[model samples]
Target chain A: MSSFEAGAAGFVLGAACGAAGAAALALANRRRLGRFLSFAAHEINTPLTAVNMTILNFISGALGPVEKTQEPWLKMLREQAERLALIVGDLRDFIHLRLRDGLSMHSESVDLTPVLEAAVESVSWGFSQAGVAVRTRVDAGLPKVLADADRLQRVFVDILYHCRKFRDSGGIDVAAEAGLDGRIRVAFAYAGVKSSARESALALDLYYPARVRKDQLLTATGLGLGVLRLFLREQGGDLSVSNQPDGRSVITADLSAAGGGR
Target chain B: MAAKILIVDDEPAIAENLQAILSAKGYETSCAFDGSEAVAKARHEKPDLILLDVMLPKMDGFDVCRLLKSDPHGAKLKILMTTGLDRMGDVEKAFQCGASDYLIKPFGSVKLLQKVEKLLSGA
Candidate 1:
């Protein structure tokens, strides 16, 4: 080979090696971050659990009352204890996402309607507290989908959490249907858009919007959507969002029929 | 009378575990879960010392501490803020809000007992 050709080949080889090294480093960094987050979660979770329990016991009469002279101080201590637990829980969940590996699937044939209903029920208290109305539209004859029960529950939880964040007093609509390709599509629609940004704009590529400018939805960190996407992808499913002209946002998840087996 | 201690947090297992530990050490232990109820119980109980958590629903620990310290009736109570936040700012803020001292979470039983003993002795 000519010297020029030899040099060109050498350059190509060098570039390939460089790329491989970069990829390896990235993977290592990611794993390290995951481990760090897991450790952090444990640290926060343990104390949070303790703090939460202490408060519960106090209220339940497992611990008796404070004296009249010390009443004001005791009350303040109690409130602060509860707040600490909330912050710790949020931090732990967020860190878990950062440190988690891609979703680990354990699929089985499952009636998804009940799962969705449970999701709705789980958040009903928060919805009522926030004054939001929730509605459902599961097809009567919808086929059971193969899915990881835990992950599927998480998907619904994410959607419901988003709906609760954005809309107050307005109604949320959840509907499921069978697609022509033997896939099941579940959609969550709220009456108002938290943002006018198109569904594509909500793509996972972009970090959650810095601020939710839309009036209808509560401000969200978008971490929930990111985690939901990971879960869906593991089950051979995909999640997408669309912005309707009437200022509504519809989030849909499509799951393959193959996802139903154990 | 032995000094009574109130521990306010939201996690049940932690509370139960700690109750066992402290009760064995001969401290009269009481617990509470949320801010609103914690306040109610404190007013009723008047614990000798309080182990307070910083983050809470309805009201936060700082505000709770401030409310208590501001009240003449509650001003004498010794408040020790306990939390997982190790940030210097959080510690400073806790002290600024009238917390007598601060303890980081995941503390060993020995450390907790030691701190409790110190606070009780000082009081």
Candidate 2:
């Protein structure tokens, strides 16, 4: 064989080896990053938990007597702590979903009543602080739906949080009923802040567009909607948003009923 | 007598804060800083409920739970697993290892109290 051809073959082999090494290094770094994120989440949550427990002690008068003026400050502290905790949680979940195939869920027959109530409870404080009222109605004896209770609760929490951001003073009505299509539908209706069609579409995107006005921003982190949508889709459910004619908007989530819509 | 609860957490501040909260609610409480200590204390004290933390210095909370749960005397102990890990896999593992309930860290006081009360009453 000619020396020129031999040199060319050697160069090709060298390049292949270099590319393989780079890919290996990247995979290792990715794994390292996943581990680091998991560690960071646990570490942050531990201290945050302690702080929350302490705040509760002070507010409940378990530690001592809280003066009238101190009460409002305590309330504010509690709210801020809750907000920080949620951000940390969302950050962890966002990274987890990106790194993993998807979240693992154990679907079972879950009563919608408690799940809706818990979701409302989780975000009710924020709603009240924003001068918004959330009224949840689960039809009496509502059929159980097939879902992961925890994930379902979070889906509602994200929607409620989203509603709180869009509507400052108006009320939000959350109603769940068995859809005729053999699925359970939960609707969140509220007067929404006006936005462009593009902005509305981008709201559920991984990150809300920076071009949107400050007051019209959907979320500070813009992680909830995207994560919640992925979670719903994973559970054989779907989420949709619609802007009504009267400047009001509606977000609906549909889930299959347990026992094949029994 | 008020129900006794064993709070197991490596973080001293967390353990102390939980003690104060439960104590104020008229429940007797004790603290264990690691998984081995948690197992020993739960065995010796036989508390009505154990607020077990998953991460520990010696043996992790899941092992401690599995160990105690294997003993006939400890089978009835209501172990409420607490963790800073938000993974649903950990939650499912906690239940698989016989945790009575699971509470993610940063949970509010009312939630803690409600779960403790419900577990104790149901016992």
Candidate 3:
């Protein structure tokens, strides 16, 4: 072969080799980032867990300091600790969902009734202390949802928590009904101090789960509204919000019911 | 004469917090700072239950659990894997090695005591 043709052939081979090398490096970086996130999340959890538990002892009256002066401060500490703990948990789940394949991580046939009941149980003391009643009407024998029971409980608990936080001297009505479109819809309806964000909250049908882009993940962190929706979608459901006819904000999540491995 | 519990964790804050709470509940509580320390304490102490952390220095929680489970004294001991690694995969691994129960981090007083009570009651 001529010198010119030989040089051209060598250049083509070198370009291919460089492209392969770059691809390998990108893959390695992705794996390293995942490892770092996992380690960070694990480390953060230890101290956070200790602080949260200390607060839990107080909240449960284990400390025996029922002084009237410390009531407000104790409540605030509990709420903040709960919030931080939730964020760490949500971050861990997000990391796993990002690093792993998808819903296959925790997908299973889950009964929604017990999950909601547990969520309600978790926040029962808070609701009672705030004089906010909670009522639930989960239909019997409702088709199970193919989702992670833990995350599903979190969605319900987190939703109820917000309602209880922003409550306005009334109660919460949680009703679950089997939807006609191969789904199970659970609603958390409450009447709270109305705000300007009411409309925007309903209009926030932004992260649809199916289209969870990488940039979207970066933007959505902690236990934000977007994160809640992402968790639902990650389990093959969609979250929507609508104002009740009685002026209450109703946050509804429709998850695909577990039917024949759906 | 309450049951004894070994709190195994690398973090002093977590270990002490748990130790305080368990002691307050009338259970005899001991502390171990790492996986190896945990094994040594379990072997010598022969506690009724152990609140074992997943991550530790020198040796990790899983290895400690595996080691204890194989020991004759720890054969029937109740091991509760307590850690921040709340993922199902990790939980399953602990269970595979014979964990009595799994409790995630940041647990409340009620939850922790309830689990401890149940475990001691042989549930």
True-vs-predicted CA distance for residue A61, candidate 1, Å = 8.2
Largest TM-score belongs to which candidate? 2
Model 1 interface CAPRI class: incorrect
The RMSD of every model to the true structure, in order and in angstroms, is 15.3, 3.9, 5.1
* Number of the predicted model whose DockQ against the real structure is largest: 3
Ranking by DockQ: 3, 2, 1
Candidate 1 residues A102-153, lDDT tens each?
3234677878888898778756655665677788888878888878764587
Q: Can you list the residue pairs that collide in candidate 3?
A: none
**What lDDT tens digits, residue by residue, belong to model 2 across residues A1-262?**
6999999999999999999999988877886787688678778877887888788788888788999988977887887786677667666766666653345568888888989998788666656776788988888777888888877887787788778777745799999988777788999989877666665666666555333565554653336565667778777788877777887878888888886852
lDDT of 3 by residue, A1-262 (tens): 8999999999999999999999988877876786688678767777777787887777677766677888767777776676676667777776666653343357888988889998888767667777888899988889888888877887787778767765666899999998766678899888865434544353344453334544331122235455688889888887876666677867798888888423
| Residue A242 local lDDT, model 2 | 73
lDDT of each: 0.69, 0.80, 0.77
Model 1 vs. true fold: TM? 0.51
**What is model 2's DockQ versus the real complex?**
0.51
**Docking level for model 3:** medium
- The candidates score, on chain A by TM-score, as follows 0.66, 0.81, 0.71
The DockQ of each candidate is 0.08, 0.51, 0.58
